[model samples]
Target chain A: MLHLVLFLVFGAICVAGAINLLVQSHPISSALSLVVVMASLAVEYLLLGAEFVAAVQVIVYAGAVMVLFVFVIMLLNAGVEERTKGSRVALILGIPGVLAGGLLVAWVLIERTGTATVGLGALPGFPKTIGNLLFHDFLLPFEVTSVLVLIAIMGAVVLASRPEPKNPEKES
Target chain B: MLSLPIFLVASVVKIVLVIFILLTAVAYTVWLERKVVGHMQNRWGPSRVGPFGLLQPLADGVKFLLKEDLTPPHVYRPLFIAAPMIAVICALTSISVIPFGTAIPVAGHIIPLQITDLNIGLLVILGVTSIGVYGVALAGWSSNSKYSLLGGLRASAQMVSYEICLGLSLVGVLIVSGSFSLQQIVESQRGYFWGFIPKWNIFYGCQFVAFFIYLMAAYAETNRIPFDLPEAETELVAGYHTEYSAMKFAMFFMAEYANMITVACLATILFLGGGNGPLFGPPLLRLILPTFYFVAKVFVFLFTYIWVRGTLPRFRYDQLMAFGWKFLFPLAIANLVVTALVVAYRS
Candidate 1:
């Protein structure tokens, strides 16, 4: 009973934060709202018994990634976003389009899963279990993903670093 | 298993007790730092207050409370107000998962010294402390001053950089213990290796290198000397809290000391065989011995913190970043890989 209540509360917070992220005009406020969303999502993960994943979600997503996001926003000194005129076409089609897509996905999920309820913390989300799975079962994919990340990091370093100038300035 | 009511009551009591103790410790840590640093510099620190300046923190608290609460006109009001609270909250919250001692039976219920023991206790501390960056960052940005802005930016960058080293260093201990739970890690370090030397992670697993990395990373993380480029007094005035006054400034000060205490506690738990020491005398003494040992270890760590502060000069911005990335980062990686290889081979 307690788990369900807590889950609903955090789920509400997550959705509310997402909406706030979109609504906030200031870039910093939006970034902070996104952090709230990430944190609430972590709570949701905890409710589902994926303790390790939950911790990682907070550590990596809410903590590191969002810190970088806020850092960039602060460094850039971004101001409040200017209000832009809405496109007539988007206004006419966007709302209904989103509604229909959401309804379609909900219909499909309910049809397939049929009101089945999994008990809280039913899955083997222990760090040991996850480690075993990552190492033994999905080692290849994990290694490939890590390599992909490495390449991205290398690319960033290359892009960030200045190339040697044709003529160096003389030291005073 | 404890009944729901008993569990809830126990948890609340533990929370209250821990917070009270932690706040008191935070206050005293400030006193300790001043006294030690003053003595190091051949000066008497806060001697005018009660008995070796024992009442200094209380006097400071009252002064902060009575002083004018200043909010400059040209500042982001909401975040400016919220920033110190965020910093202090995250600082105090990380202490929740740290086990001070073994469980004690109370009215037929086993109550652990810690507030709660999450399976991912170490990660929780890491996550919460990581989140604490925002407090300093936002405080700087919202203050609408050049010094504050520079301080905030440096803090974010430095913390983000060193957090990697901090996390990496602990991975060695995690591998040795094979558990993320702090309690389990402490339990694993119980017995002596050579019957004389305690089988702490540093000695038993040959994690002295990791401990060194962790120490450096922690100093950086807590914005202590040599790594405190974010709040360099000579360059950025008072850094992130330059514009803050009264209670708000006090909150930031409390947060820094609280973080120091948390880091010291973590070091004790991870590397010093937390709360594990010789037990003697009556049954009651045995029950209290573990906590005593834990506090003593933490005191040593805290003293080292102040000692280093007194001895070392602050690092330049570029040098600080270089040291973290070029030196500590690769060293931590090397330590992790070698530790992993040894563990794998032995197993």
Candidate 2:
């Protein structure tokens, strides 16, 4: 009963935060709302017994990922993006666009997910079990993902490391 | 879970106790740091407050509380308020998983010396502390001053860099202990290998390299001396909290000390065989002594923190980044590989 209550509360917060993430005008506000969304999701993960996933979700997604976003926003001196008036044609199409988009998403979700309810504490995400699963059964996929990351790093370095122009003063 | 009310009662009680102890410890840590650094600088620090300035933290608290809390016109109001709360909350939340000692029978109930036990206890700490970076970052950005901006930038960057080293350094300990649960780690460290030498991770698993890296990373993570370029007085004038005053300023310091304590606790549990000591007495004494040993080890770390603050010079910004990325990162990786190989061979 208590778990159900916690799940509902955190679940509501997560949804509300996601909506806030979309609605906030300032980039910082959006970033903070996303962090809230991630955190509440982490709690939901914990209530589901996926403790390892919950921690990783917070550490990697909310902490590292969102911090970088905030850092870049600050570095770039981003304020609230300026609003532009939409054309009259878009105004006429806007209500239909929203309704159609919402219908499509709801349809896809309904088509994919079964009516089966996920039982609480059904899957305990103990670190030992996760380690075993990752290294033993999913080793190749994991190693491939790591290699992909390394390649991405190399690509970033190559892109960033352009030679200076002959006249540095002119470049400045 | 137990009967909902019982679980609530126990958890609430544990939370209150831990928070009380943690805040009190943070208070004394300020006193300890002042006295130690004062003596280092050839001064008698805070003797006016109470016996040896024992009540200095209390006096300081009163002063901060009584002072007028100010908000500059240029500063962002909501974020400025939220930042310190985030910092203090994240710092305190990690203590939920830190076990002080073995279980004891209290009022016919077997109570573990922790708020709650999670299988991913260590990971939980890492996750929670990782969130603390926001408090620093937001505090700086919201302050709407150049000094605060630069300080916040340096601080967030430094924290992000060292956090990798911090996490990597602990992987070696994780391998040796084969558990993320703090209680299990302590249990694994209970026995001695050579009858005299304790089977702590440092000695038995040869985790001294990881330990060193962890300590260095922790210093940066907490923005202490040598790693505290964010708050270099000569440079940023006080870093992220420069614009803050009164209790707001005190919150930042409180967060710092809390982080220090958390790191010290982790160091004890991971490297120093937390709460494990020579046991020659009765079971009751045995149970009580480990908590004492645990606290004593944490104190030593806190003392060393102050000692190093007095000794070392702050690293230049570029130097700090280079050291973390070029030096510590590679060292941590190397240590992890070697430890993995050794563990594999032994098994």
Candidate 3:
């Protein structure tokens, strides 16, 4: 009973934060709202008993990623976003498309799960369990994914580097 | 097993006690730092308030409360107010999971010294520490000052970079202990080698390299001397808290000391075999001695902090970043890999 109530409260907060992220005009405010969204999502993961996932969600996403987002926003000293007239193509297609996608997902979830309630902390909540699952059950896929991430990071570094000077000695 | 009502009440009581003790410790740490740093520089610090400045924190608290609270006209109001609260809150929150001593039996219930023992306690501390970056970042950005902005930017970057080293360093300990719970990690460190030296992670687990890495990374995380570029007085003019005045400023000060204490406590728990010491007296003393040992270890850690502050000059911004990323990061990773290999072999 307590878990359900807490879940609903945090779910409401998560959705509210997501909406606030979109609605806030100031870039910093929007970024902070996004952080709130990330934090609440971690709480939701905790409710589902993926404790390690929940902690990692907070540590990696809300903590590191959102911090970088806030850092960039601060460095750039971004101001309140100016409202612009709606782009015709986006206005025409985007809203309906998003609504349809959301409805489809909700319909599928409700149809498949049939409103069945899961007990609080029902899934494997221990780090050892998760570690075993990752290492023993899904080692190949995990390694591949990590390698993929490494490649992406290398690509980013390459892209972000400045090109060599045409005449380095002359410039010096 | 404790009844739910008893557990709740005990939790509340523990929470209150811990917060009070933590705040008192934070206050005295400030006095200790001043006294230590001043004596190192051949000066008497804060002696006017009380005997050897014992009541100095009380005076400072009252002064902060009585002083004019100023909010700069040009600042962003909401975040300017919220930043210090966030900073202090995150600083205080990590202490909840730290087990200070053995369980004490009272009124037919045995209560652990810790407030709550989440299995992922170490990760929770890391998570809280990560989130704490925002308090500094937002404070600087909202201050509408160039110094504050630069300070915030440096803080966020430095903290983010060092956090990897910090997390990786602790991974060595986590591997050695095979658990994330702080209490479990300490429990694993019990017993002695050769019936003399405690089998702490630093000695028996061969985690000295990791401890060194953790120490450096922790210094950076808490923004202490040699890594305190964020609030460098010479360049940033009090850095992120320049616009804050009175109690708001005090909050940031409190937050810094609190973080220092938290880092010290964590070091004791992870590397030093927390509260594991000899006991030879009555049952009451046995129960109390562990906590005394824990506090003594933490005090030594805190004294080391002040000692280092008195000794080392601040690191250059580039040097700090380069050291964290180039030096500590790889060292921590190497330590983790080596520790994992050894643990696997032993098992």
The DockQ leader among the candidates is 3
Q: Which lDDT value does model 3 have at B40?
A: 97
Model 1 regions more than 4 Å off: A111-114, A167-172
For model 2 the local lDDT of residue B45 reads: 90
- What's the CA RMSD of model 2 in angstroms? 2.0
In candidate 3 the C-alpha lDDT for residue B341 amounts to 90
lDDT (tens digit, per residue) of candidate 3 on A1-172: 8889999999999999999999899999999999999999999889989899999999999999999999989878788899988799999999999999999999999999999857788989899999999999999999999999999999999999998999989978
| lDDT (0 to 1) per candidate | 0.93, 0.92, 0.93
* Candidate 3 residue lDDT tens string, B118-221: 99999999999899999999999999999999999999999999999999999988888989999999999999999999989999555999999999999999
* Better-scoring candidate (TM-score), 1 or 2: 1
Error of 1 at B222 (Å): 0.4
- What's the lDDT for residue A105 in model 1? 96
For residue B104, give model 1's deviation from the true position in Å.
Answer: 1.7
Against the true structure, what is each candidate's TM-score? 0.97, 0.95, 0.97
Q: DockQ, per-model, please?
A: 0.84, 0.84, 0.92
What tens-digit string does per-residue lDDT give for candidate 1 at B287-310?
A: 999999999999999999999999
Candidate 1 accuracy as TM-score = 0.97
> Would you list the clashing residue pairs of candidate 1?
none
